[model samples]
Target: MIETLAKLVSTKIKTGVTQKELGARINMKQPQIAKIERMHTLPSFSTLTRYAAALDLSIKMTVESIIK
Candidate 1:
């Protein structure tokens, strides 16, 4: 899940928004964005929402029972 989130962030960043710019939009810093993008850190739910908003994206979560 974290890896997928990281990939999502990377894809958004590749859409012409630099880490620094995205961070500025989210009131964070480039290093923090880098850490999240590199999967070195996992952001909280609120932070994740902020990232999505900054990139004009949305998050959708689904859960399934593994025991099924």
Candidate 2:
């Protein structure tokens, strides 16, 4: 789950917005975002919810998609 989300947040998708931008939007610190993106920080329940909202994805859908 963590890895997939990180992959989705690669530099390629960092054009219109970067990790720092998204982190600010979600009220998470840049380091927190980086750690999450690097699979170093496991997201909390609320963090996951916020991430889904920010990425415009349903938590269930996002999680299910990463079930591999």
Candidate 3:
């Protein structure tokens, strides 16, 4: 989960959006965004949503049972 989140953030950052700009949109600091992108910390669900929004992305979650 953490790796996936980091990849998503990195992809967004590659699209010409600086971490500082993204943080400004989400009311966070660049270091906080860096931590998230580096997988140094995991954000809460709400914070994840805010990150997605700031990156002009949306998150979709689905649950499946391991047992058939």
Candidate 4:
């Protein structure tokens, strides 16, 4: 799931924005964005949300009860 999200962010960034630009939008550093794009480190949920928002994307999570 995380890799998927990271890939999405990376793809959007490739559309013209640089990692540094994204970092500025999210108040992060270019290296941090690079790490995320490369999946070298896992980003926190809030960080992922911020990343998505900066790219004009949205994230939705659903939890369902498990019954045996």
Specify the highest-TM-score model's number: 3
Cα lDDT listed for each candidate: 0.83, 0.70, 0.81, 0.82
Candidate 4: worst-modelled 10 consecutive residues by lDDT: 4-13
Which sections of candidate 1 miss by over 4 Å?
Answer: none
Question: Whole-model lDDT, candidate 3?
Answer: 0.81
The candidate with the higher TM-score, 3 or 4, is 3
Residue range 1-68, candidate 2, lDDT tens digits? 75547545753275466778788879988899889877797877678768767767545543356566
The C-alpha RMSD in Å for every predicted model, in order, reads 1.8, 5.0, 1.5, 2.1
Between candidates 1 and 2, name the one with more favorable lDDT.
1
Comparing 1 and 4 on TM-score, the stronger one: 4
Clashing pairs in 4: none
Better of 2 and 3 by TM-score: 3
Model 3 residue 20 CA deviation (Å) reads 0.3
Give per-residue CA lDDT, model 1, range 1-68, as digits (tens): 67557666776858988889989999999999899887788788788888888878777788889995
What 10-residue stretch in candidate 2 is worst by lDDT? 57-66
In model 3, the Cα lDDT at residue 16 comes to 80
